[model samples]
Target: MVSVYKKILFASICIFALSCKSKKEEATKQNTTQQATLVDVIIAGTQQLSNTIEANGNVVANESLEIHPEVSGRLTYLNVPDGASVSAGTILAKINDADLQAQLSKSKSQLSLAEKTEERLRKLLAVNGINQADYDAALNSVNNIKADIQLLKAQIDKTVVKAPFAGVLGLRMVSPGAYITPQTILATLQETNKVKIDFTVPAIYADLIKRGATVSIINNNEPKRTAVIVATETEINTTTRNLKVRALLGGVPINPGAFVKVLIDAGKQINSIVIPTNAIIPDATSKKLIVVKNGKGTFVNVETGLRTSSGVEITKGIAVGDSVVVTGVLFVKPNAPVKIKSVKNLTELTKEQ
Candidate 1:
C-alpha cells in the first residue's frame, strides 16, 4: 500500500508539469499571431513644392486711347462707323477746312514770291548794287512768309482726325455737319490683343512678387490663361498696406473692365515631403501621423506647410522613403507591430516586399 501511494503522487506531479508547459506554449503562440497582423503603409518621397497667393482683380486693356477733337469746327466728314476696327493713322472724322485750305494756298504763293525777292536782293548785294539793310529786310520777309505757311499747314492737319493707335474704335459722339469743340469726343480706341490684370497684394508679400513672375488669370467670361507680371508699384499704399501688381495676358480673349482672379507664385521651390491628406490625423493639440519603423508602427507629430487638393506638404517630423500609415492609421497605436505589404502607393517605387 505504501508503494502504491508513492506511485500515485509521482503521476500527479507529472500531469501538473505537463499542464503548465502547455499553457505557456499557448500564450506564446497567441502573442506571435497578434504581432503578425498586416497594416497598409505608404512610402513617401521628396517633392518640389511651390507656394502661391490667390487674389481677385479686374482686367484692363494694355493700351486705351480716348479720341478727342483737337480743333473747334463743324464736323464735315464722318468716315469711321462705331465699333470699327482701325489701324494707326486711320481717318475717323474731318472738320470743315475749306477756308483753311484756301488760306494755306495763299500762304504758299506769298512764300514763293518772298523767296524770289530774297534771291534777287542777295545777288544785288553780292554785286554791291543793293544796300545791306535792303537785303536784310528781304531775308526777314522770306522767313516770316515761311513761318505763316507752317502755321497754316499745322491748322490743316488738325482738321483731319486720325487714329493714334491700332485698336477697336468706340461709338462716335458727334455726327456729320455737327459743330464740334476741342472737348468733343470723336471716339475711343482700345487695344485688345493683350490684357492687363491689376491686383493688390499684402505688403508682406511684396518682396516675393516681382516683374516676370508667372501668374494664372481666370476671367469671368473666358477660360483660364497663363500670364506674367508686367509691372509692379514700387510704393505700397499706406491706407491699405498693399502693393499693386499688373500682369499681362496674351493669346487669350478678354474684355476690358472684366472681373478676373489672379494667382501668383510667391516663393522659391523647396524640397519637401508630402503625403495624402487623409493620412494625417489631427489630435486635440497637435497634428500627428503614424510611421512604420523596423516593422513597428510609431506615432509622430508633424508640422505642415502648403495644403493642396491632393495632399498636404510635410515640412517636418518625416523624411524621404519613410513608410507612413495612410489607411487604418486611426486603428493603430504607438509601438504597435505592423506588417508592410506594399510601399508603392506613396511613391514611384515598384512593389517588391
Candidate 2:
C-alpha cells in the first residue's frame, strides 16, 4: 500500500508540471503574433516622368569671330586693349590713311571750285549767256568731282578696323605700326551673354529632338545650366550614327569650347507611378517591389520605365495609392507581418535626404 501511494503522487506531480508548460508555450506564441516588425513605408503616387537621353557636349560662343582688317595697310593706330569689351562698330585699329586723307582733301577743294563754276554756268544759261553744251560740261565736272571725293572717302574707311558686334575681345594678335593684311588675325571677339552648346545623340533620338526642347547641362557631375534646342542636323552622321544638335544656354555664362554633359528629354510627360530607387530589389530574373498589403509584406514583380535621380518609374504591377516598403526592404520577407512606423512620399524623402 505504501508503494502504490508514492507512485500515484509522483504521477500527479508530473501531470501538473505538464499543464503549466503548455500554458506558457501558448502565451509566448500570442505575444509574438502581436508584435509586428516596424518599417517605413510610402504611398506610391503618379508622377510626371520624362525620358531623357544623356550625351557629351561642348560649349561654344553664340557669335565667335576673328577680327581682321577688310583692307591691308600699316596698323597705324590700335586702341583695342586685350580682353576689352567693345560695342558694335567700335574702332579697334587704324591703318595708314595719310595718303587717303590727302586725296580726300584735294577732291573736296576741286569739288568746291567745280560747284562754283557749275553755279555760274547755270545762272548764265538761264539768261542765255552761255550755250547749253558748255553749261552741260560744267555740270558734269561738278558731278565728277563729287564722285572722286566719294571714292576717296571709301578708300579712307578701308584703313580702319572696327568691332562687328558687342562682345569681349581676346588677346590682340597685332600691334600698332605692324603691317596687317586682310587675312591677318588682329584679335578674337566672342558674344558671351549667351552661349551655344553643341552635342550629338544616337540617331535613334533624331525624331525626338525638336526645336524648342529643353536640355540640362552638367559640368564635372555638377549641374551648370539649362539650354534649349535651337536646331539639329537633318541627316545622321554615317560614321558615328549620331545626330548633331545645337542648343542655346541662356542666363548661364559658359566659356566656348568647354566640355559638358548634355541631358535631352526625349519623351513627352506621362503620368506614372514612381517609388524610391532604394525600394527596388533587383533579382536576376526580375525586379521586385516590397508592397505591404493587409498588414503583411508582399513581393510584387514590377516593370520599370525611366530611372532618374528623383525616383524609379513603375510601368506595371503597381498602382497609385499603394503603400510600398521603402525602408527595411532587404530585411523583410514575403508574407511577414509589418507595422508602418511612418509614411512619406518619395519627393518628401528626397528633400529630407
Candidate 3:
C-alpha cells in the first residue's frame, strides 16, 4: 500500500510541471503580440482628375512667302506700297527687260523676212522653177525664227514679278534703281485674314485631340480666342515627344508670326489611385510601397503614371481598399505586426506637411 501512494505522488508532480511550462509559453506569445509597432495608415483610393497642358504657339499666315525675283536685273519699277494689300497677279516689281524687248523686236523682224522668203520659194516651187530642197530650207528658217521670237518674249515676261496671291506686302528692301538677284528678298507677302496657330501638344494628349477639335489661344493674356484644329503631324516628335498641331482662326486680326500660348484639355481620368511621393521606396528595378494587411506591413511593387502637383498615380499593385502605411515608411518592417493608430482618408494624409 505504501508503494502505490508514492507512485501517485510522482504523477501529480509531473502534471504540475507540464501545466506551468504551457502557461509560460502562452504568456510569452501574448507579450509579443502586445508589443506591436504603432503606425498611421491611409486607405488607398481614387479621385476624378482633369488634366490641362500648356503649349507654346506662334501665329502664322494662311499664305506667306518672301517676294523673290525670278531673274537678276536692275529694278526699273518696284510697287511695294509698304504694308499695302495687293491682289493676285498684281505686279509687285519689274526688272529692266529693255534688252530682252529689243531682242524680241529684232527676232520679229527676222521672222518677217524669213516668212517673205519662204513665200517666194513656195511660188517658185509651184511654178517648178526651184528644187523641193530649196523651198523646204526656206520654210524651216521661217519656223526657227518664229520659235526664237517666242523664246525672247518668254524671257521678257519672266523679268516682271507678280504677287502670287492677295496678301499684305512688307516693306521693300530694294528701290526702283536697285539691282537685284534671285536671292534678293524684295519684301514679304502674307495673307493674315485667316490666321493659323502652330503649336505642339504633349504626345500623351494626342488621342484626346483630333482634326476639327478646338484649342484656346492666349495672346499675351488677352481674351481667350478659339481656334479650330485644321491639321496635325503624322508622327510625334522623337526628341520632345510632342505632336505638332495647326489650328485656324478665321477673321481674327492677329499679325503673322506673333507669339501666342495654347491650352489643351485632355479629359478626365476617373478612379485613379494616387499616393504620396514619399511613400514610395526606390528599388533597383521597380518602385515599392508598404501596404498594411491583417495588421502587418506588406511591400508591394507599383507602376506609376502622370505625376502632378497633387501626387503620383498608382497604376498597379495596390488596390483601392488597401491601407497604405504612409507616415512611417522608413520604420515599418515587412510582414511584422503593426498597430494601426488610425485609418485616415487619402486626402487627410496628403494634406499633412
Specify the highest-lDDT model's number. Answer: 2
For candidate 1, write residues 1-353 as lDDT tens digits. Answer: 99999999999999999999999999987897686547677777877777767788888998898888899999888876888788888888889999989998898898899999999999999999999999999999999988888898899999989988888888877779999888878778899888888999888888877788788887765666898888988899999999998988888558799888887776677777888877889989889989898878889999987765457899889888888887777677788777776554644322221
State model 2's lDDT. 0.87
TM-scores vs. true structure, each candidate: 0.62, 0.62, 0.63
Candidate 3 achieves a global lDDT of 0.86
Model 1, runs deviating above 4 Å: 1-50, 267-353
Better of 1 and 2 by lDDT: 2
Model 1 per-residue lDDT at 352: 24
TM-score of 3: 0.63
Model 1, residue pairs in steric clash: none
Worst 10 residues of 1 by lDDT: 344-353
Error of 3 at 31 (Å): 32
The reply for model 2, stretches above 4 Å from the true place, is: 1-50, 268-353
lDDT of each: 0.83, 0.87, 0.86
Ranking by TM-score: 3, 1, 2
lDDT per residue for candidate 3 within 80-128, as digits (tens), equals 9889999999998899998888888898889889999999999999999
Writing each residue's lDDT as its tens digit, candidate 2 over 181-298 gives 9999998999998999999988877877889988889977566578899998878999999999999987757778889988877767788888888888999999999889999999
- Give per-residue lDDT, candidate 2, residue 51: 71
